[model samples]
Target: MNLYRKVVLSLVIALPLSSLVSAQDAVKQLADKLQVMDTLLANFQQTIKDSQGAVLQQASGVLKVKRPRRFYWRTETPYEHLVVTDGKILWLHDLDLEQVSKQPFSADMDKAPALLLSGEIAEISKQYQVQALTSQQFVLSPRTDDGVFKQLTLEFRGASISGMILRDSLDQTTIIEFSSVRMNQPLADEIFQFTPPKGVDVINNEP
Candidate 1:
């Protein structure tokens, strides 16, 4: 999958939910917390597991997200891959493949989970049915069936997001743990701009 799809899919997955008034309240509180931060930067370790709970893949990376619509995600270990979006264009660079792909940011892309990180909290309620498992842990199930993810779980440490777990229709599970998280930090505008290096083939995926 492309970087955009990967991140978006990872952010939305399916999980079972239990109805409880306290859980719903916790979800609301978590939404309130997300609304206060305009930017998030963190180091993350992600692990993917099969339906049988066998490890499928593991990777570590740095993730930076800016409100409205901008982000820089780089996987540093296992391999080098970068994905950046400057609100108008999306760039994916595959260091091993020596290729870079570009596509115009479209409305469909706006529906991705990047929006959940940057868009208004009210929109979140409109898109997902949230159930809180604990004061700091919440599960979100997409309101629409068009999404590939079945459910997504988010865990927070105080006001900072500490981990995320996603389960897809195929029963594959992806767990991402965060550390060194810094919220509302000033990130340079240039970090979201990508200029493909010399000798790397540039593929225009925009139609």
Candidate 2:
């Protein structure tokens, strides 16, 4: 499945960091990187093939990231969905289902690997250990929480993240490759705020 599909799969479970160096020092370095507000936008194309090497999905999109937590994700082809977080709340919109689900940005934010895909590098590296895996790739494994994602591999060329691979407890891996990254740009605040369609089902987890 593709990254987007994996995201939706997370919803079904009501869902649900790292480092190398010294686990504590690594987390600090990662948190530092995430604090950098230099990059505001990233674009890439992803190919997701099953473990059997069968083509499963292909997608392209841009990711807008802002510091202190905020991002907007948009995808193209096959189907469409929008995922946004405003540091406090996470809004997931399913186009086909015409439904939107809201969760505290912190609900599973710390537990889900998907957040790492779009999360601040500093925050991520802080929670996990960082290991140099080849020339352009790195692997991050959780230091405190082992029940979430077993491992996360990230590929980079310079400061741009070229790809992401997530390994969960179920042994399912979701990989995303990125290209055409444009960093240090300006993205509007409205993009991170989504309004679900009227009359659509709204599932509020608030008690």
Candidate 3:
């Protein structure tokens, strides 16, 4: 699967609802959570289901995130793909393909979900229009002519993000669930660096 498909397919689930929450309230709650977080470490269980409500795939991993665009997503699952991003570049390594892909941070800054990884919370409001709070989630739709991703739904447990549902322009939905999250943990910058192995195909998609 491609990167977008892999990411989109990883968030389906059939778990019970943990609580009753409001979307408007959740938006405020999400904003507060992001506002307060400088760094974070956590284990996540992502269960992706199809539109028919069938489980497609499941993956678990430990995520380490630092402020100003840095993340380490190490997967322990059916397949392995390592994604890392420094403030300057994004690296995606496919274990199965033994291939590495790199892109300039600025080239795909708007298209890539870099803001979601970094502490760039200030621009979210400017780029998207916040909708009314729902019973279990808050919704936001992009205000610009951005390609593909049409809307984003965020599900929360009190303050922390419990899940995220993304809808593309094609009406395909991708849901992401986050659990056991630890916030404000110290992280080393070296963890985000990428060095491709010998003989592996390297695709540089940066402009």
Which prediction has the highest lDDT against the true structure? 1
Alpha-carbon RMSD of each model? 3.3, 4.8, 6.1
Worst 10 residues of 3 by lDDT: 8-17
lDDT scores of the candidates, listed in order: 0.75, 0.62, 0.63
Q: Provide the global lDDT of candidate 2 against the true structure.
A: 0.62
Q: Estimate each model's TM-score.
A: 0.85, 0.76, 0.77
1-207, model 3: which lDDT tens digit per residue? Answer: 654335622321011223435433544555665777778777766655555666666777667778777767767675677777787877777787787888776523533442464647666655555554554565677667566467777666765557667765555556666778777767789987888889999999866
lDDT of 1 at 130: 83
| lDDT tens per residue, model 1, 1-207 | 644346433452144445567546766787887877789999989888889999977888899988767878788877788878878888888887798988886645544553466555666766777877777888888778764667778888998989888777788888889899999889888888889999999999879
In the range 118-200, model 2's lDDT, one tens digit per residue, is: 55554564466666545466677766764656777767676666777766666556677666777667777777787878888
Q: Considering every candidate listed, which one attains the maximal TM-score?
A: 1
Q: Is candidate 1 or candidate 3 better by TM-score?
A: 1
For candidate 1, give the lDDT.
Answer: 0.75
- Give the Cα-based TM-score of candidate 3 against the true structure: 0.77
Residue pairs clashing in model 1 are 13-150, 13-151, 14-150, 14-151
Best of the two (1, 2) by lDDT: 1
